[model samples]
Target: MNFANTGQMEITTLENFYRDTASLIPEGINKEIGHFNVFKIEDVLARQNKKVMPYNRRAYYKISVISGKNKAEYADKVIDIEHNALLFATPKIPYNYVPQDDDQHGFFCIFTDEFLIQSKSGVVLDDLPLFQPGGYPIFQLSAEEVDDITFIFRKMYKELSSDYAYKYDLIRNYILELIHYGQKLQPATTLYPSHTASARVSSLFIELLERQFPIESPQQKLNLRTAKDYADRLAVHVNHLNKVLKENTGKTTTDIITGRIVQEAKILLKQTDWNISEIAYSLGFEQVAHFSNFFRKQTSFAPLAFRS
Candidate 1:
């Protein structure tokens, strides 16, 4: 019944994650860079004691190889896996893993952005297409691809427990390998190539908008709530930003902004028990009545009605 503190409706911190699953963090982790840990899917499930994974954002990044029937729900999308798939999760988006059957097998590793810093890998976590806000993070794998990924994960598991002085470095390479492999598996069309200034601006605008998300706590308010707000952040004139967005997405700047806000509103309404006033304030509405009017206009349903 005490689900709020259990991360059912808020951001789950790494410490809470370990506690919830009855898993132990490795002793003497290198806090200078960050933390890294890998686990067998079954090992984590066995310790879960049937506790459902919370549909909330996490404070860290995660890579998971899920085998078996499962469903993944994000704030904006849902993916159902009938057999095997690779999932990449970031702290910006909240997700819930629902296993449709009792049989589950795979591996997952949790890490922080600093774990593979630019100094080590010359790779920025956000710059990766798979981890990007608009990128496709899940991939259905072939049997051969699954075997290849499993092999790398097994190497990580072994390296993590080794006495080698540079084991962490080796693990970082393994993580990057997984990332690149996923990128290669992505459909050619899904990978956006910024060939022009307008396209680049449009892409940056979308990324900036998505980075504010999952509204993990009541006190966390949205900083960019209007077209002008985003325009200012992107150092572009409001009219220019609107023109770029309209040309690229077929929706005016305000339309796109409000559309995303409405999407988040729906997720909050259905996933959390927060009162309308709290939700309104978090979404940058000064009054619940205003939020109600906006929600009704966008969704044709009152917040309470939608929740029910």
Candidate 2:
């Protein structure tokens, strides 16, 4: 989400999202494994708290129950939720919601891909149609459906407070059940418009970039790390690609690519025990020294030093 092409759209991380949405520090036992969180709007308001969500792509999946009149603006479509409804959001899309009236009511929860991976399914959350590109991610709820959805949220909140060892496993199943419930409502209809030339190139460039990610193992090396590689795949001159990116995101192609790699490097260093060389090569650096130098330049810390 930190690419050059993202102009006014900001990226909201889980920690900051919690602070903004609920005015909480996200402390306690789950701080280290802080990939999941839940909040009720009523609870937040009763505490006289304020919500501060801007238009952006949240770095996680958000499922919520909303009531009254509210509007959600996505990349391709604008949806108005009336009465009770369920809404789904993914990282691939940038969106924001504005309350049309003072009667907003809801429960919301956010979880990262890693949160779901810990479950038995062993699947990537982004690969699911519910969160995939050009897929439907919203549903309206009847009063009965609202009751059912609220019940699911109640189970999640209750399990999250329990001492059960397998609570997350049960929570994951409930999340899946909610997802399947939405999927069964009707097939996902593509709402995104066809891209313009510059927009198309940028979109293709992003898709090509994300394709190299998650770096499943040390044996997996990133294929597209430079501006030239992306330009070639997009069938455009490298200069043209760079110009479009700069125009769209206020950053050159190389800057955007490096930012993404460095961000990934930090994530791997923080989340996994991968050795320096493994992390280095997986990110497409030829030598550990080069990766070390790059990481230091970008983050002001040596690789192992950062890990420590």
Candidate 3:
């Protein structure tokens, strides 16, 4: 959870984010935001000895349009944002931003999902392609896009202090507009556009597989644990999924599925104290014996022995 130079930070509140960097917060702002707030950094270098933000999950969603140079690290990818860039941040993912020099300045807004979901628009934030974790959330904006985005953020800044009763409705519209803009540039037409059919199928298959993960409780069983199940969910034939997986990864669909299941099983065995039967049941095994045999075949060790 800790980065190399910077210690560690788990910022879940707006005040904690703004308190350390007073330059970012504008004056005359209502000192309290029940769930959301917008801040524009007129001078990014105002704070001396600025440290890099480490990868951490926060309880807020952030959309920032930065107009300078900076490097961002998200999960396993590193992105260099030159000129003006529109970046999206979500609570489900971890990310980091390292400012380049003194000239890094931009506008960023933070809000809880409740802020938008409770609005009259009834938008499902996570369901949007722009907000989805695996979808592209960062864009190198054209000058016109920058101007358009800037106008929205500026409107948000002005409306934050407005006395209008329906100002929030207008602000929500701005937020949605920003998202739609990003979506228009993002891979809304296709999640991954590869050259070969094998690559596309592989990428899509992996995405579909990942959508079913991070099993939360014993009461919740993994629904798609087989190649056929995944193929059905992805609207592809089982043979087609197997062929593409073999072509791209040099492994059959069943092999990939089994390997992933074994990895998940090992994690559960090592990280949780769930009994073998419960773990097996949650992993889509009807009986503990079947799961034990499968685990032993895959790992060359019994589940209990591996756990011990």
Q: Which model scores highest in TM-score?
A: 1
Ranking by TM-score: 1, 3, 2
Candidate that would win on lDDT? 1
lDDT of 2 by residue, 97-159 (tens): 767777767788887776777776866666566676544577878999889888998898887
- Lowest summed lDDT window (length 10), candidate 3: 1-10
Clashing pairs in 2: 4-249
Which residue pairs in candidate 3 have backbone atoms (N, alpha carbon, C) closer than 3 angstroms, thus clashing? none
TM-score of each: 0.89, 0.57, 0.62
The weakest ten consecutive residues by lDDT in model 1 span 1-10
Q: Model 3 residue 95 lDDT?
A: 70
Q: How accurate is candidate 3 locally (lDDT)?
A: 0.73
Residue 68, model 2: lDDT of 69
- Model 1 ranges off by over 4 Å: 1-9, 30-32, 232-239, 270-273
**What global local distance difference test value does model 2 have?**
0.73
- Candidate 3's C-alpha runs over 4 A off are 1-34, 42-51, 191-208, 211-308
**Under the 3 Å rule for N, CA and C atoms, how many clashes does model 1 have?**
0
Report the C-alpha lDDT of model 3 over 237-265, residue by residue, as the tens digit.
Answer: 99999998898879999988887677667
